[model samples]
Target: MFKEVLQQLGVKQNQSSAYHPQSQGALERFHQTLKSLLRAYCVELKGDWEEGLPWLMLAAREVVQDSLGFSPNQLVFGHKVRGPLALLHDGLKEVSDPPQGLLQYVEGFRRRLFLAGQMAKENLLNKQKKMKRLFDRNTESRVFCPGDQVLALLPLPTSPFCAKFLGPYTVVRQVSEQNYLISTPERKRHSQLCHVNLLKPFYSRFSESEKAPAAVAIASSVTEMAEDVKVPEDGILQPRLNNSETLKKLDEFVKHLPFKQRDELSSLISDFPMLFSDSPSRTNVIEHDIDVGDAKPIRQHFYRVSLEKQRHLESEIKYMIENNIAKPSFSSWASPCLLVGKPDGTYRFCTDYRKLNNITKPDSFPLPRMEDCVDAVGSALYVSKFDLLKGYWQVPLTTRAQEIASFITPSGLYSYSVMSFG
Candidate 1:
């Protein structure tokens, strides 16, 4: 029945030797782990195992497997499954607004899935290397050149008094590393190719006396290999500092900086490594409160854009929508968008909020003067500074403020979730 099913699917069946389950070691190990997990999850009765199986499977898929270095769901679906704990941690709310159209939603998911597949493939390769390193720690390379006489350990059962070693077989050729074709004394090819682990050097003079001991040594070596693989001395491999790719990249980047700047950066970073990050910091919430002070809402006329500017503005709107910086709005207030050209030949998306600012009263609290600020900083023993990528946009606006800050565009009316400069 299985063969018929495979034939229907056009898959060739290659069964491993049942006598040596180690041939399918990976699957066997997985089965063993699954049984252990099932046992832990099903603390009740063996008959109640079916009730907890689904939950156990979900937990298993969500966890990072040792061999793959990723959760099964992540590898298959290209994203981590959000559990109840994850939702709770994220405040039981969506991080960003969903795409406006069905087509856009599908495209976004597809793009993320493709990226996830690439990431999972890289992680799998790294994990395979790590596993191989531990497995090959005490393993020595063995090559059987043609014409080398070796004894093959057969799978046949024998009595306590009978000889276990098969024969002084001559190695015909090395089929591959760890596998060799063998022939009997009569130069007839053996039915099965012998693995290196079950083959030993055959001495003609001491053939009878040494055969048992040679077989014993081969068996012990195979057993040791299995033991070492199953239980590595080090549970987790530690990365070497000298072989760090990140440090190498950092060194290359530092070489491009000015001499004094590099020295100052090195000293500062060496003292405060956590201050450095590959990505910019995120602003999760608003840091200040703004009072419109009973200022009436202002609605500005729609700004005109050329055919080229329309496409650029549309692209910028898409970016803002995707990043959750802005969303589609239908509010009483509206401002016109102004495309300001930069010195670098790029356009900055801005809003004409001059009319709105004129009506809104300014905060009475004043900031410290330049001299006073300089004197206050001079008293400090150590000082460090960093710039926010988009300072104004980092400050989130209130829901009411967002409606009041609505802007008109060719695409539609939109409101900023964060504060924007005029």
Candidate 2:
């Protein structure tokens, strides 16, 4: 099939066999001889092997060949090779004898070839040096200051080589001006203080307001009870608004609220806002009371509903909570149950033993003997298949292990109430 495909792609039978060593001995032998000459030339010149490739090719072309009865150059150009002095003498003779323009043309061709070879050598050396520098400087280090945030580059857990920069950590401690201790809440271990060159400052929405001022001025001071401006702490800076200014802002926030709610909000601000003298107040609270005149709250007796209907509702709620199928919050007391509907449109409930089964501990579990399994499968033709439907949901999780088993989805962090494993 592969041969047919290659033939269809325009690969001739002889060309296809060219890759085999036995079929291309002559070409392979030539390549070996060319490589040997290149190595010898590079060693003598104290240069890279790659630097001698073109020169080796030129030398090979000009060298006499036993098979061809002349140099490869002569075979191609239909002429005999000559030294520089011989060519020069020939050119003078040509000027006198006036034999076509061949001698002058050969001199111009030699000059062009020499110039091109020189340029190629310089370009190759420059490119090699650039590539070597890149490989030499593989790892980079960075630093950060106290309170500064930085992203930490880390490897992916599944494929460490395929890892990438994974974090935006906060620099909680500055060990030195050039090194800082970064903090990442999601990471299991704390990262070491890194050098300044590798650390880049994290730009956040609040960074602009956090910049230090050029000069200490009263305009940037915080206001106290007597309208007296206080200088900010050494590393700490105040926002544009002062305490009295913030109080006025708070008053403005509650202005649209009901009179009673506004008074309550003002009282809470007067107490809490006084403690944080430098902190800016950006939050507001509003409340409204609804009037339900002549309306009474509904009350139901448990005995009023049919036993089957009550069971049905409980089962539905249990299923909703177990599978995280509903957005409604479930109480901790909710239990797992099964629902059964009757022909009369009523439903019954059956309590599930899954909750109790979860609490029971496993006494003994066997470990996988991977080596033995591999040995048994050796030299055998076998098909491998995988099942992914309810892949994680099918596994049973212990009650004590459920907390760690909880995972975050688009909806929220949820612990499976039923057996689930991966």
Candidate 3:
């Protein structure tokens, strides 16, 4: 029934020979690694491997393969999946800012899947060539042509005491570099595809006059013994942070807290390192858009600026373009730019959008009063205030709004890739 289902699904089943475990290169390597892991766990913990199986599997997924250039978990999840140990080292530095919205996650998943598939296909092709080289290097080479007779070691595990190596089968064909199809005349249905390791060439001891026509002819190729099994790599089971380093770092982190509450607060923050950030995060939780609503293009001429301000505006424009906050525009709408000086001696490149604002249709929906908002949050156990950083720029503008939000400058006409302050 399973075979029929597979056939209907356009899948071919390729089964290896029974009880001869050689030349299954990738599969054998995985099994060897799993066994090594289980054995080590048993030795260290003095317990059965069943309790540690889940952790062992997760460890395997976290290991990066040289051929794939990614861990199995990263290829599957399409994001950084840090185990607990990662927090000790990675959190001490910086957390990458990637998780902003659902769209980024979806795109990353698709990209990782595509890269993994391409990498796996290339790796398989190269592995075949590498295996052929390794096989040819350290062993005697033997090739069996068609029409050769062979004695195959076909084991019957159900009846262990029985003489299982009873095959005197004729060679059908060579399926691959080290695989073959062999069958006997009496039992044609018992034909099996086998590795070259399971076969041996048959020899005849009779003279020409006394010889019978029924001697076995075995065709064995020595190449089926695959490359040597690789030992599992040594790695830290669990990372440890020395007391001196932890205390020094912890002291710096909790220095501002009250002396009595430092220990408790430090523990709380340390327990959840992912929730804290050293700097303001630019998040895209709210997608703000400008709605001009069929207003005519407001084309204002460029404003005059001093040569010094012009140079600053040019540098600012270059920076915004490089960082993807703004882009060059060919829109029909534009407004004059302004240079507002900051108290810290730097000038802010501002846009004058009075004409654009005058033409735009207003949304006049009434907002809830402050008293009503405060009433709605009555009896709350906790209240937290978050001040968004570069809040206007964090939200993305709609495509149509972007054209309407364009501004004129000494350099050229440009549009905001993100929402911009007027």
Candidate 4:
């Protein structure tokens, strides 16, 4: 049925033998990227990987392939996708509407795709040749007889201390050129046939008197078995600053600050001593007012919590109270808090404001366009960028707004004194 479907599409299926993932080069490469992206997202979001799937797909298509010199999206569309940067630079003009007439558009698109395919194919061939040259540079070639002793490297657990390449397993027979069937000591067939790259010739100088485990003759490092893992010519690894070194640099930087600026910075530290705490800054609070107007207060019950998370939530509430960021409340409005994992491996306390936002009137104030802001900096001799620390919490909220933003917790009901992240 699969072959029939391919025939219908005027394409012939080229099937290779199973169990050799390296043969499907493109798919294997994509799988590597997919795994890496998913792992990163899962780590950052604490297993909320589903939320990152769309981003993963977008990132994959936008990334330029090393061999093709073009992103998957670009090759298919015959142009790069208009991302945020592009849209910011050129406004709506960055993504113009397609040609009106369907037939004419199809012909144009077809021509563009054909040209792109030709270019991609040529580029891929050149890249393959270059890669092959580099690969052969340090690769040691060795042929084995039918009964030769060899060790086959197999996939193992992903631990730094775990052995990556294992086996003093015997070579069963030569399946094809540079390919061999391997087996155990009892002559049982191995899991799969291995390529020449996976097999290292096992040389025995002494008489066959020594008996060792399969992992005994394994390579010390990946570089010993693979040509790609080469050390730098300088042989010196880059120096990473220790904690003390980092502190010393910061102290040195502080020493260079102007007297007036130092005084101003010191004033902020003195005024907002509690700002160093995890809770909101007490200096200037921004109360979030739910202008329910005539609508009734929307109160939500506290959600079920895990023991570990409940403890964290309690600790976070205490931290906020100690810093004067939050206080006990009897407000009619209430919301739930979600514990999200931050990149730093700490949990960020987030409130679910969806219920409130749904009934609230949308703010229509337009933000300045990125293009205009960037253009305003034209031909400047020197430019400076400043990031406000805890900018949202710096704005104080009204007393009424605080009550409207109350949330229920395991310990008790509480409300923010300053603006909170939702």
Pairwise TM-score winner, candidates 2 and 3: 3
Candidate 1 stretches with Cα past 4 Å from truth are 1-25, 45-55, 80-101, 158-166, 183-190, 205-422
Q: What lDDT tens digits, residue by residue, belong to model 4 across residues 186-227?
A: 333344577787778776776555554445554333323345
Q: If candidate 1 were superposed on the true structure by all CA atoms, what would the RMSD be?
A: 34.8
Q: Pairing residues by index, what is the TM-score of model 4? A: 0.39
Q: Give the RMSD in angstroms, all C-alphas superposed, for model 4.
A: 24.3
Local distance difference test values of all predictions, in order: 0.73, 0.53, 0.74, 0.73
- Candidate 3 per-residue lDDT, tens place, 62-156, comes to 78766556777777776557764455547787776655678877887788788877886687678777878988787775566677877877655
Q: Can you give the TM-score per candidate against the true fold?
A: 0.37, 0.19, 0.39, 0.39
Report residue 52 deviation for candidate 2 (angstroms): 1.9
lDDT of 1 by residue, 37-130 (tens): 7787666555567777776677667777765566778777766677543455467565854547888767876887787677778877897788
Poorest stretch of ten by lDDT in candidate 4? 219-228
Tell me how far the alpha carbon of residue 36 in candidate 1 is from the true structure, in angstroms, after superposition: 0.3
Q: What TM-score quantifies how close candidate 1 is to the native fold?
A: 0.37
Model 4's alpha-carbon lDDT is 0.73
